[model samples]
Target: MQNQSLTIKKEKILTGDRATGQLHLGHFVGSLQQRTALQHQYEQTILVADLQGLTDNGHNPHKVSSNILNVVADYLAVGIDPQKTTICLQSAIPALSELTMYYSNLVSVARLQRNPTVKNEIAGKSFGSSIPTGFLTYPISQAADITAFKATLIPVGDDQLPMIEQTNEIVRKLNYIAQDDILVECRPLLSKVSRLPSSDGKSKMSKSMGNCILLDSSERDISKAVKSMYTDPSHLRVEDPGKVEGNVVFTYLDAFHPDAAYVHELKARYQQGGLGDGTTKKILEECLQEILKPIRERRKTFISDKSQLIEILRSGSQKSQEESNQVLNSVKNAFGLNFFQL
Candidate 1:
């Protein structure tokens, strides 16, 4: 009998953000933490998706252009080691756009319209009756991002499950048409933590709405945001029994507080009509201040050297460009489009 042993390939993680604004706690809770933890465990890439940022903000290109470095700074502040993870500017990688164009043909307009995530965003953006074609087909572009690097894992939120499904759809179709497994299907690494709602608790945290506490927010800013956090309106008086559900303060406490038992105890006391909102908010403010102070300091240092950030982006983009070019070549050959040896 022959001894048999098998080696498993490490899973590659591809995650990123649209460079619309500075990253915030919503990003911290959703993906940044996971990316940092996974960096040492697997090969990871973070794309500052400037092109995707342009999909909706085509009218004000400056907003997208200006925030690219801010986004990179946030990544550095949050413990994303550039040595372990490749952080690249999306537009610099020409292969991604080319792949997007090729992948677009495999998907349909009707299919893009049906994506629940895109539809919800379109409504939120008030793009009614005039959705930009780029905005509508961004999921295809995301497919290109994943497959271009041959990523096996994509960290996403629950709302983004449809995007992963759509990518795999493209992967299956292209593989079938090419009669080869040229592209790999990727899976979503959903965050275990729940979504972090805005401090106002009226909607999701958004930079445009100023409802988010940015990663680079000052101590005063974090404290102010925490103080204004939505708590139980019914509990007007300290003696009045407070409702924990829909109470943004306790929701954050549950998410970020160091001790679970302590948070649970506080919640019980508040529900039983003793703890005051002021006291609770004060506690949360302290917690947030402690968490954000280090991040702010680190971000400040990263921003001090503009050349360093540019170099980081240039080097990462160069590495990604080479990898993506190889994948794009394979894709073109699949379509019989590599007509010339050159």
Candidate 2:
């Protein structure tokens, strides 16, 4: 606990999402709530990673570009105050791109291919023999993002630990080659609830799949999603015993429901018998609606004025430029690339 407090006091946190879609309940549990709570304790920066979003969606660039403001709204809706957290756009940070170019040389194609995260993504995308260079070396760009900000802590999922591991690898290699400590290594802060699966029990809650209950979803949408959630298939009767372990309704309850003792009791009844899926689903639905209604309202208000949203992003990106340029200059000096005074 002392170590956690120490890290919180001293470390700057950098975390964000790809600008492909609006965030969902899964994101709320995994990181957004943590960001709102940590903003005052740490110097936090949220990057709208449009560039990274383009990695797989290059063919549909509009999808990445269109959701930038929506993602920002999701941030604000969840109580990430702009005054407390610096929210920036990745595409606007020139130093990050320059750093990515320089750092790319330090990472080998073989090494990029060896990254477990990248390998898994490649297998999932089925990019076979035609993988984009940008998609494959994404870890290098992420390394640039982390080092450029001198961010010491990154909030991410367990699956992203490999990315964090590879970031430190680049930091160590860069410092070694430069014979100076030009970059700071970052650590991953995994959420207590590491992942929230899809409502249909297919995979991780993803926007592309249309199975996630988005933070801004309408009341009807929430009800429909909850009703469709995957539960114990064999529990055809309310009197039959049900497994709470893989039950999506109970899982959501555990993550979102505030009363742990109450949720525990519900789980016990579910496992023992006499608790129907409808009852569990209704409980989860009500909990989610109560939690998300305010978020939806706030998100609606933020996105109503598009110009204001753009200004917020612009101001934060400018702030990031100043901070990132200092790190970039130190890196260039280490690499002997800073020739002109200007």
Residue pairs with clashing backbones, model 2? none
Q: Tell me the lDDT of model 2 at 94.
A: 98
**lDDT (10s digit) by residue, model 1, range 62-94:** 999999999999999999999999999999999
Which candidate ranks first by TM-score, i.e. highest?
A: 1
lDDT of 2 by residue, 91-118 (tens): 9999999999988988899999999999
Sequence-dependent TM-score of model 1:
0.97
Angstrom error of the Cα, residue 78, model 1: value is 1.0
TM-score of 2: 0.96
TM-score of each: 0.97, 0.96
Q: What lDDT score is found at residue 229 in candidate 2?
A: 94
